[model samples]
Target: MAKKDKADKKGGKKDKAARKKDAEREVVNGVFAPLVTQTARSLRTLLSRDLADCGLYAGQDGVIQALAGEDGLTPGALAQKLGVKAPTMTRTIGRMEAQGFVERRADTLDHRLTKVFLTDGGRASLERIAAAAEACEREALHGLSGKEVKTLLRLLLTVEENLQSAIGKR
Candidate 1:
């Protein structure tokens, strides 16, 4: 296992001890996890509803958002940006191309290299979709205090960074 993964596992001791002080703590009751399912479902459901006019899915939004800043990217680059398998990226791009979200063309500098770029529709959809996502996140964090939200975001970002660093080693 990677050093980061080892460190991630190392935190269990602290977490276990911290929870031991509580007289009663909430427990999940599912084959999967309530926390995981709730957030995932909420994001997907909200995005689907809010972005319906945009003609995009929750998974496809990442590519559009990435292309919004950068003019174009190679399949390998897109895969990295989305943190997905190369084959999965290929399929997603193929579907997006069919949907006219993105287009592919041979690179001018390297004829063999094909790059992906967003269509005008893709660009327009992204701005609204992003706003919708921001709203969704705002709603999700509504009950939490500012400090609690910041801490939660910090912890989630740490986990993302740690796993990303470990993934790069592979």
Candidate 2:
């Protein structure tokens, strides 16, 4: 009887593990996560290739664009706007400063606060960045019609909202 009970417990454990795996499979296969991940990877690859000529990476252009819209933004503010951590922003800003793309200036009102400003080089490179981005988008959406593009945008926004809600729960 003891041996039979031990076997039953082992079978129960196996059943539990199988149930967990089924749940995981449902999450992975049903969630569109793989599609989203692959699409993101493909877009990043295309963007990297296009931006190579300008000597800027995929994420750096965002900073340039942000600065173009609102110059003299603090590092913390830029980090938050870009959805990046402070250290990562600091490293990127440091690299941009070294490459003469941006400069750090001490705020007049608050000497402790440093603001980032785009240099002449950064402003000049904006055209190239814009061209590269346009080319990448055009290539990615080569076959999509205007209406299809709009539909795709709507669907993607919906997906983003769904994911945002899921993240909020966490």
Candidate 3:
């Protein structure tokens, strides 16, 4: 019975070790989903830190860029354009308003509806935010050549389409 107990303990330890290795292997190469998610999260953290110097958050830059292309969009319209939820867009816009980066205007046709516009500060901040974004991209792709960057972008877009298709099927 003593020998059997010892053997069982050894087997249990081996099983645990094997499970740990499997988890590690999964993260390393088993599936692309975990890798893609980790890459996205890491990139967001890096970009957020860099954007902080410009007084903007990671996701806020996208909103600014969208607004820059077309100003005075309703909150819902902006949310749809950015692919963000309505509540999230509202919170972001509220923060930007508090920071003096955006302002809300009553829609001329409908007083009840509000539209978002970039404030003077927001227009000026665009240059800095753009530079920060470029710098972050350069840093992230420091070792990659132009061809490699293009390849990476193409691969990412393909992955995005695959995921979108999967979501649509669901």
Candidate 4:
């Protein structure tokens, strides 16, 4: 009777949760996912903690933020800024419209385009979302000073740009 390899043993699909946990460990245990996952989940947790009562989900808050920044943007333009496709942005915007957070008007200049606007309720939500997001950032970057935070942000952005450049070449 030979012992089974840990990888093979773990590979057996016991249940969704078990499989998910295993996969997470593989991807996240060491450094890559730990940092990313912690950063992401913490943000979500903090945002939810501060914002769930206000009825904003992670993605929806983003849409609200975008609308608040620019009062009248086409769904296509919103999609580009949010890094999503037009179809996806359309769906998100539709939901927001239903929720009374946004209003869409047909573009007078371009009837084919629908412009998105934040309502009064939507503007208030933006304030909440911004506060929640900032709270999460403060929580996540607990030790860094102002200058350290600035330097870290610059370095992280540079890394993101370099990664994008490499990806583009490939």
lDDT winner among the candidates?
2
Sort by TM-score, best first. Answer: 2, 3, 4, 1
Q: Between which residue pairs do clashes occur in model 2?
A: none
For residue 93, model 2's alpha carbon misses the true position, in angstroms, by 0.4
**Model 4 lDDT at residue 134:** 84
Which residue runs does candidate 4 get wrong by more than 4 Å?
1-30
lDDT for 69 (candidate 1)? 74
Candidate 1 lDDT, 3-44, residue by residue in tens? 888788779867877786552343333433567678879878
After superposition, which runs of candidate 3 have C-alpha atoms over 4 Å from their true positions? Answer: 1-29
For this target, which candidate reaches the highest TM-score against the unseen true structure?
2
- lDDT-wise, the better of 1 and 3 is 3
| Candidate 4 lDDT by residue in tens digits, 1-170 | 13566655556645667978988888755886468668778778777777777876558887887777788999889999989998999898888899889999988998987799998889988777877888888888899899999998998898789888999999
What lDDT, from 0 to 1, does candidate 2 have?
0.92
Worst 10 residues of 2 by lDDT: 27-36
Task: Locate the minimum summed-lDDT window of 10 residues in model 3.
Answer: 26-35
Whole-model Cα lDDT per candidate?
0.83, 0.92, 0.89, 0.83
Ranking by lDDT: 2, 3, 4, 1
Report how far off residue 150 is in candidate 1 (Å): 1.2
Error of 2 at 65 (Å): 0.7
